[model samples]
Target: MDESTGLTIHKSEAVALTQNGGLAKAIKPLTKEIHLFDTYVAGVSYLKDKTVLQEIKIKDRLTLQREDNKFDDKAIVVLSSDGKKLGYVPEKDNIIFSRLMDAGKLLVAYIIEIKKRSIDYQQISIGIYLVDF
Candidate 1:
């Protein structure tokens, strides 16, 4: 009401603009990444030892450490959970992976499956998962 002018104003009930509800639910967590880079493990002299690949179990976590001090700067050695040397990442993929590791990104590798019958990749197969904070 406007007392000075003796005028009055009326308003209708407020209506919500939303049809169903508020904002949609937060986006689902991203599925873990699984990238298989070419592995140099095939022709490496060390895999020659039948026992080196022994004791490796499926779903076993692996650690990738940069071998900058070694002759191959891009060399990323794969280590078992028990600190055993599994092998080196392929040269083509090692550079990218090395940079990612040096950048302090968290990546986890696990023995996805063991190919006992397959002619290729017969030792074991691995999957790398990205760890998001």
Candidate 2:
């Protein structure tokens, strides 16, 4: 796969979806059968190309507050696959973000939104690539 193109694609196995509580186990005693439910595809794209599309409303809302002073002293944390903190990317910096999507590994993204006097993001999009053979 080409990293320069900024594309990510991977395959995953579907497992049983269980309820947060003991709802499934409680119902198991009432019935002896378990049926498969509906399924849907979840596609998450993190590219900055024309082919990569994002909702206009979300994009607009993300950059609604465009000001310098608002993000002067804010903290932005970046993470790696092993739950290690990489560093912080400035609010208005153009960053090329990449991540690995292993078969059973989890990807985490944390964003702390703070309502302040101003906001600004020089780079609105992130580049993503999947390099699994």
Please provide TM-scores, in order, for all candidate models, with all chains considered together. 0.58, 0.20
Q: Of the candidates shown, which would achieve the greatest TM-score relative to the real structure?
A: 1
* TM-score (C-alpha, index-matched) for candidate 1: 0.58
Q: lDDT tens digits, residues 14-61, model 1?
A: 223223442222222443455645243323345545454667778788
lDDT of 2: 0.28
Q: Model-by-model lDDT, in order? A: 0.63, 0.28
Best by lDDT: 1
- Alpha carbon deviation, residue 104, candidate 2 (Å): 26
